[model samples]
Target: MPELLEVEYFRRLAERCAGRTILHIDVPDAHALADGRSPRSLRQAVVGRRIELARRHGKLLVLETDGPALGLRFGMTGGLVVDGELAIDRLLYSPGTFGTAWVRFGIRFDEGELLFHDPRRFGRVSLDPDESRMGPDAMAVTAAELGRALATRGPAPGPALKARLLDQSAIAGIGNLLGDEILWRASLAPSRPARSLAPAELRRLHRHLVATLADLLERGGSHTGDLMAERHLGGRCPKDGSPLERSTVGGRTTWWCPRHQH
Candidate 1:
């Protein structure tokens, strides 16, 4: 499934579509975007009411209707791209809408409840009123906030690092890719105990965490840096000349240079 960056990249597709007065709902309770409610909500709240712009929080992308006030989560296997801009009439709601959807991506939601396309079916979509309700996007969160979250880690650092990062409450949007990015930037072995980091090292790691992500977004690329090597039978990292190594961490394949990353 696509990670956060991919999810965000695709989410932009929703912006290109011409919402011809309305759209259908396919995703679940949280799936405003998945359900067509995101654009609907935006049209009603944003376009109708005339709001300025919107933003994304962690995995949740919110449209600033400000009038209707809504947040959307694309879930896995869900995102948009404006390939066709056609919307048919009341004949009946069908994939035709997607042709007009200004984007051409759909799972053809079947769950009477809502469709969640997680190959592992491990991904989910959610919503909240505002940042106060949904909570802040991790990228916007301050170092102090991150430190407080890390401060409560387990006596051991490795598990602690993984747990805190994986937990959405401590920090939103730090998915598997982000965790590896953090570990890689810190040059600290992912298995290293979270509590074992020296104060200076922790500070540097935290700074790198934010800076690395910023640079990736600035460059508009994957935080993976080289996320694919985790699966490459034999591959070379794009950065260093060292041979890539692959192993499992938290049951997820991880690739890195022992020399480049501690």
Candidate 2:
């Protein structure tokens, strides 16, 4: 899943695409279009307009245009490429699959082109002007705001910390991997209730959340050297040299340093 860092990376790329007039748009995969929006409708909305700016809320990238705004949701395997160069997670992609199954949509300009590539087809291009569907951005929210949101949803919580973290309405932009990473860094078990954390623990979690995001963003949004990286292949904990633990949290495979993360 494309988390906050990944989406922010895309927003930067989309920023370069700003002021470029949309000469054409090719919708090779109709399934990539969000429900209730068609290829023709999307084309008509953006074909002649200029992209004014690009911004992100949560995991959704919004491209503000002279007319309607464009929202991109990169599901599980979605990314953006401009002029044959990968923007976000550039280290993970290769030039071999530019216009293949990975590409769902393409926007052409006079000088270059931008492509939305999603191999799994779970990504989406939406024309919905209403952004009220998403909550506050993860990087933009304060610790106090995060605490209140978690507290409201975690009322009488029991082992739903991971699940609550994945809830966009509660706190946007966190996914399965980020949830586990933050919890591990904070030494908080995902199986523990969110409301169980003390004031100090909440502060620790907030610090870890902000720090982890800053580090990953500095590493181009997908650093393999992260604490919980590659634990799926029986990797050990980076901090304690102990075998990492794996389990299903929020219905997603989660890995953590058992020796260090309580």
Candidate 3:
């Protein structure tokens, strides 16, 4: 499956690729496309009107059109076409990252539809009014609102690390890949009791989250969120190497150097 980056990443990509408005929206498998809306229908929905914004929240990619918003998910195999040209082939994308963007690609009157090619058709495209009211995303939630949401979810930060990282209401832009990376870096056992984390451990985990994300975003936050991986499944750990181990945590592939993670 092609990695599905958080919407914020896509949104940033979309926003940067400003010009030649989105001529058409294509989504083969999406809840919004429920009941079936033809590609023609999608074309009619957004042929003109400046792309007010393009963003990603969680795994959802949103392109806020002057008229309606376009939302997309890259499922297992999906990509974007600018000006009717498929440029995804030129990029050496990482595992945790997916979708299309040239660091910053734009054009004026490019006058071509943004094509989403997904062989499996597991992804979808849709039009909406308010983007904030979406799923598995925290774009709409304010910092304070997110804090309140976290408080309600419980401050015990260790037990359900997976749930916490995947929770859209908690912190945006984190998915399975990032969650595993963060946990591995912090040395907080994946299945450890959330509340059982020592104060120092909790602090360490929080710092890792900030530091890790900050560093990646500096590189444009591609579909692959882990910088250490650099596209390979196995590599020498930055901290230590004893043949990095790979496992399934919360149903997602996870990797860590046993010598350093503990």
Candidate 4:
């Protein structure tokens, strides 16, 4: 799946389309349209408008045009291909090869083209997607913002720490892999209660969260995290010589070093 790092790459690739006028749009799969949008409605939105900029919020990519903004959500296996250049060479769990039949949507510019390729058809395209629902971008989130997001309001323990991290409404751009990596690096347990953290722990969590995202973005993608290799059945922790533990946290597979992450 394309996480924050991968989506950032897609945003960079989309920058190629900036200042280019849309000559045509190819909606080979109407199911790719999101928010109950139809092909005709999509065409009516931005057929001949000029792409002014490419922006990203969490996993959503938005192409600001002279007219309406175009939004893209690359579900699990979707990718961006601009002028035959792929934003990412390959995605984990995605097919190794590219097929023409997988192109769900496309845009023909005056000079080149951009293709939204997704074999599973889980990707979506929308016009003027609502960005207000999402929290702050994970890459730029402040410690205060994170504190507010994780602050417990009642006597309830609240959601698990990992669940809070994975919540796009609380902190945008964090997916399964990044959540585990950040928790592991911060030496925090995934199943810890959201409200259990002290001020110091919150600072540590914020530090690792920002650092992990930056490190992964520089390395390549979310799959390149340090804890990625030890996410399996018999995998051992790279930090200590202890056996890694695996379980379901926040409805997603989670791995952590029981010896170090407390």
Candidate 5:
């Protein structure tokens, strides 16, 4: 799933389309638009309009245009790609391979093209302007703010640490990947209660969240040396080389180091 860092990465890529008029928008698949609007409607709303700005909240990316804003949620496998041959080839040749099908949608500027590629149809695109459903951006939230937000869920028997982080209202942009990584880095258990965390633990968790996300953002939102990188190949703990544990947490598959991630 696209996490906060991945969403932010796409936002930066979308910025390149800003100030340029959308010469055309091709919705090859109607499923790409979660709102059930016709592709023609999408084209009518965006074509010929200038992309004014691009912003992201949690895992959602919103492209503000002179007309209507386009909301993008990269469900499990979605991303924006620039006009690079390697990217285009990936879409054209490897169509439907690796859960990645052809371009769900695309935007052609005067000199370039932007493509939304998703293999699993889990991603969503909508014309609505309602972003009020999302909480504050993960990267922008401070430690104190995070602490307070997590507190709203109450203590044990409320929501587990993984469950709490997965709630966008509690803290935005954290998916299973990030939740496990954050907990692992904090030496915290995924099943631990949100309110059961000690003050020191909260501090450490916040610190890891900021630092780990910073590194991930630098890595172009791609997981490397993390459990996600090796998930398909039986991921092991990067900390102590122990076999990582995999289970469902917050309705998402989670991976954590049993030896290191207490």
Candidate 6:
């Protein structure tokens, strides 16, 4: 899936569209429009508006125009192609090639064009999407913000640690791959209770979370994590050489080093 890091790349690519007035709007796939949105509605909202900025919140990319802001959600295999250049050369789970039929939506500007491509037809386009439902963006979330997100009520434990991390309502941008990679790097067990972390542990997790996201973003995308290759049967831990363990956490496949992540 296109997570925070991937969407950030898309946002940067979209920045090239800024200051350019939209000359035309194309909606080859009506299914790509979000609920309550259509080709005619999108055209009426942004046909002549100029792109002012490109911003990202979690995995959502927003193109602020002189009129309404256009929001994009790259579901599992979606990507952004600007002026025939792809923000990402390839995605982990997506096909290696791009086809004309995969273009779900597009916009033609005075100088160039942008395409929303998704082979799986799971991506979405909307106008002025509701951003308040998401928590603080993971890329810039502070330690204090993370603490509050992980805080549990009463003495009972909250959801599994990995589950809490994956909850966009609590901390946006973390997907299945990032969640496992961050926990593995922080030496935290994926199955730990959300409230089980002590202050020191929480701080460690915060530090690792920020560092891991930065590292992956620079290296490429979420699939470039250190723990990515070891997320399989019979894979050994890179840190301790112990056998890696795989299980389901938060309804997603999880791999962790039992020897070090405690």
Q: Top model by lDDT, which number?
A: 6
Residue 113, model 4: lDDT of 97
Output the better candidate (2/4) by lDDT: 4
Alpha-carbon runs more than 4 Å astray in model 6: none
Query: Could you tell me which residue pairs clash in candidate 4?
Result: none
All candidates: TM-score = 0.62, 0.89, 0.65, 0.98, 0.84, 0.98
lDDT of 1 by residue, 38-131 (tens): 5344334333332224456677655443345445454443434333322111111122233222222132211111122222223333333445
Residue 55, model 2: Cα distance from true site in angstroms: 0.7
Residue pairs in collision within model 5: 99-119, 100-119
Tens digits of per-residue lDDT, candidate 2, 142-176, equal 88977876675423665467777787887889877
Please say which candidate is ahead in lDDT: 1 or 6.
6
Compare candidates 3 and 4 on lDDT and give the better one: 4
Model 5 C-alpha lDDT per residue in residues 147-195, reported as the tens digit of each score: 8777754444777788888889878898776777778888998987787
| Greater-lDDT candidate between 2 and 3 | 2
Residue 187's lDDT in candidate 1: 72
Candidate 1 — number of clashing residue pairs? 12
TM-score of model 3 (CA atoms): 0.65
- 194 in model 5: Cα distance from truth in Å? 0.6
Instruction: Assess each prediction's global lDDT (C-alpha) against the native.
Output: 0.50, 0.79, 0.53, 0.92, 0.77, 0.93
**Model 1: per-residue Cα lDDT at residue 59:** 71
TM-score of 5: 0.84
